[model samples]
Target: MKYFRVDLITATPNPQRCIYVGMHQDYSESFVGENRINWPDEKKAGEICVKRLLAGERGHYGPMEHVQIVFNIGWFPHSVMQQARTHRIGVSFDVQSMRYTGNRINQVAKGLLDIEEVFYLRPIGHYVDRKGRRYNYTQTQRNIDLQYCEQAAKRYYDLIEDGFAEEHARGILPFDYRQHFIVSFTLRGLLHFLDLRSKRDAQLEIRELCRLIWPHLENWAPEFAAWYQQKRLYKARLAP
Candidate 1:
């Protein structure tokens, strides 16, 4: 099985500047002279921006919509992606097409010949029993699950080999199969995503994804990160 991972790819140039531009928009009519005004220190501006946001000032969130970020997320179960796609506002996704890329297998075990490799996500807490104790699946159980997925992969490949279209052949593939994608979101949208997905009640796989992405976001915008952390509005808690 492959573990989930998230990578920060790129972000808006001078993200603080973008925030300032958005903040300026709300007060643009008040400027007496030239419309453009320069803030000497971007960090100071960011701190002020975060303060206004935390104070619940009107239109503060509008500025956050200007800052944008992109991430390369991959190797997680298709089920996790299904949950992630629910947050559709101010965000965009470019996902791998199983219909087009079904023939490509990037994972191959060392010293294993003619093996149809199938990857899955082992969720952190989904296997817990009713007593609140973690239930470790025995080797036999693991093998049984793997066998089922392997059979599905075999059927999918066989259909393709028999001249069936990939779109049709992909029907046999399991939802546990791994997939990757590039996701983009505005700062406001990302905060909303983190708020919902990082919650204790969120899906385990996606919460893990949020845990991985949070520190990177903190690094990108420390002031805003601090405000979010302090507010605790999203129930953002890491998995044990």
Candidate 2:
């Protein structure tokens, strides 16, 4: 369908400063709230945060939990959500549910929406399997798959038209129906998610999701993102 996008909903402002305060509070006996008046700039705070807390892989992730970010993920396939939910760790999701929101399906049935707009299919290409088997997904195969999706969508809509419940009618829909969702994570959780999903072995769609998320993180916490890009990104978890 040529659409997968992420929009930043909200994030803790001055995240590096938050991290610095959290990290600094851990070792300080005084009330950090008052002492934070002397806190450095976010960039410098992030540099110090990296130096003091993450430089040698200190394994101190508590500070990162203080910063929170949320995103509205749009037009990703159900499979991506399925895969991401499997390893959610400490993330939260508020997905568009078929049971409650079926306007797009109705649109498809009324010919107001293209099936391609409501569903996702991998483009014709060579893709690798978990066993390292590389196979070409031909256009012929894709067309056949498209037909199956079309049939399924027709059935789903027809059932709905016949007074079937959304919960029941949704059972006939394509497995890869495009969905929008809201997801939130702490700074540490976000990096850990990237560690797991941005790897070379991860599914392509979710990997693309992580790719879209990275820029937002970079803009939010430049120093932390830079350190993560150099160390943890697509390599290994920064901590247990």
Candidate 3:
């Protein structure tokens, strides 16, 4: 199984500056001119922006929409990507098409070669039980699952080689098959995504993905990230 990857491609040139500009739109009268307003102290501006966001001030979140972050993610299971696409507002995605890539199994005259090397997500349930106890799949069960996947891959290859279109052949692929995509999201949308997907109750795969991505976001906006961590606002909806 291949490890999931999330690569930060790019982000807003000056995230804090963008937020400050939006804040200034509401408080323009407070400054004499654009030159008079604090121009380059992003740390200080980020601090003020974080304050407003934490305090529930009007228009604070609206400014976050201007700061965008982009990522190139890959080798994650298809099910996780499908779930991720539900965050349609303020986010964009360009996913790899199975119709174009086809099933990527290696074939040999004897049988499927490198079947053990095929990328698939390990079943988390095999390692941990519902109560968080360590659990191991019986060897019999493990072999059955592996054989099933190998047979499926073989059938996929056979279908493609026998004149089936790539799109039709992809129907045999499992949800655990690895996939890739490029995705972008505004700061506000990203925060919303983390708030929902990073929770303890979220699917293990996506929760892990969010945890891996969180540190990079924190590095980009320390003040706001601190506020988010301290407040635990991600669980606010679960509160009574």
Candidate 4:
């Protein structure tokens, strides 16, 4: 939780109004952008879009694709990105590549970066897996995992120093190494992603990623976020 984050990079200004404009364009005989004088303000526009673009009888979503936001995701494990990438339609990602970057591994090997900063382990706590089996990830097991990460980093760095390519040397690194990525999504795409990753059965770390993304969505488009929170958040209500 300490390292995981979602920072907003940029978003469409008056995104709710932009969504409404798209909706207006779909039906208006006249051009919508040219009729901005009659368009609703951001909040009002958000309300209108939710009602017209996504409400029960008028379940239109094409206009939601018109609004977009970008984020810089930080320090989530590589596995999180792996899971996040499964739903790629209308989504874009530029992830930190271990193949081209080995400074963090070197830093860990040199005792500059803490092992935990380079790898992930679940906190020592009880957890139940998909089947009804329950178990505890104790402190001792976690300590062993930390040691494993340190050893892997050292081996990876040693291989690099011995003229191994970064890509070749990285084979020894842990699967859940920390990584950062830049991602952008259309509003509809964002909703579709949340529908999958924010559900009860989703992996815990990826759910955390979805949790982190929500605040930025709310701040940028309050009305849409509100509608989503009430009707869709965590319910696995797949966005159409």
Candidate 5:
């Protein structure tokens, strides 16, 4: 099986301080809640900012004090779930979860695979063949083990339904069960996260997600976005 690595970095601070560079056409000082708003027209300002960012203008935002961002990390059951949920109370995220209501944790049982294809049958062979020698093969033992784990989960869930303490019953669930969570970060926090998570050393899942998000931020908050990219480059050079 392929190990899954996921990372999520949130924006630092809150939106209260950061002046959103874009969204001027429809955005106003009132929209962002600024009493001493200064501009010819909120609509015109927003329009111009959005246009410029989309056109690739990057610089220092009005003030870095107001912007904040957060991220939701996704991966296998045990990997990022715990960390994500932990960040939920402290940070904010944009992912869905089953933790709110008492519900069954999602499950997608799979053994380690030589390739990325999904298979639903038992395979009988050594785990891996190397130099004409097979190793790590316990022959069907791995499958049997996972099956037993699934069964145990089902039994524990039933027990909980029958009045057993859920806290204890839940102990039986394995780490691979899929979970979801939310995390909130400010613009500053996001920059910090990206500085670490968006680099070549970052995990694949987080890095891919960063690639998807950076462009959007570049459009939404041009100055702040540009600052993040620059910060990332500087930090990378410092990595030994």
Candidate 6:
């Protein structure tokens, strides 16, 4: 059970902007998709370039501002709050703050809480029944948490309706409740972020987002993308 949805709303340099800036090497604006490059084949490209980039054996790469990408990340409230601290790549989120607009909740915009990150620890009963059974509890607890959150949110809304202060009512909302955000960054910044967040040491939630974005960018900028992949992705076998 996944607790969130991550979408690449828009990326830059836009195909038009790339054309305007003469960044397009092989395709025209009309023919080019949003990023100007299509990449079902460039998965290997990232693997090659990201390794070299992270090794400090950089051949040629400039400042991080060459390319820009924006992500619409939908996740539990706790995740968004934690992710807000990831300022290395110019990250920003549209948080549902109770103090801001009072009880005027944006019902239309708030994404539903989907259980994604945390896995449930099942009881010993299942394990004893089946030796190889690896049943996940993500969906189970999510259902539980979601029901609790909904009731809490509803109660909070009721409190506000009855003249309670927004701040006080919002206390009921759990950190795992849904929240949305927009993260943007330049190519260089993204590279740095990837080096840090895409590693095994990074948080699983953020790492997932980085993994998804890497492939999307490969087709858009093969040269730059390749370089990044060589420098960062293959950090294991490559020399330091």
Q: lDDT of all the models against the reference?
A: 0.70, 0.88, 0.72, 0.89, 0.45, 0.52
User: Candidate 6 at residue 178, lDDT?
Assistant: 50
Q: How far is candidate 6 from the true structure (C-alpha RMSD, Å)?
A: 9.3
- lDDT tens per residue, model 6, 172-191: 66555555567776666666
For candidate 3, the TM-score is 0.84
Best by TM-score: 4
**TM-score of each model, paired residue for residue:** 0.82, 0.96, 0.84, 0.97, 0.48, 0.57
Best by lDDT: 4
The number of clashing residue pairs in model 4 is 0
Candidate 1 residues lying further than 4 Å off, grouped into runs, are 29-37, 56-59, 105-118, 123-136, 233-240
User: Compared with the true structure, what per-residue lDDT tens digits does model 3 show for residues 1-240?
Assistant: 246788999998768877877877776765524564556477887887877755553435788888889998887778888888875446898887888865465352126555434546455345655678887767677668778877778788888879999888878766577778898988888877877788876778888788778987888777777777776545733211
Ten contiguous residues minimizing lDDT sum, candidate 1: 106-115
- For all predictions, the C-alpha RMSD in Å is 4.5, 1.3, 3.7, 1.1, 9.8, 9.3
Q: What's model 6's overall lDDT?
A: 0.52
Give the range of the ten consecutive residues with the poorest summed lDDT in model 2: 231-240
Q: Estimate the lDDT of model 3.
A: 0.72
Q: Is candidate 2 or candidate 6 better by TM-score?
A: 2
Clashing pairs in 1: none
Clashes of 3: 0
Candidate 2 per-residue lDDT over residues 21-85, each given as its tens digit: 98888888889898766999999999999999888888678889999999999999999999888
Ranking by TM-score: 4, 2, 3, 1, 6, 5
User: Higher lDDT: candidate 1 or 6?
Assistant: 1
Q: Alpha-carbon error at 19 in model 2, in Å?
A: 1.1
Q: Which stretches of candidate 3 lie over 4 Å from their true place?
A: 30-33, 56-59, 87-89, 106-119, 123-139, 233-240
lDDT of 5 by residue, 110-131 (tens): 2232211211122344443334
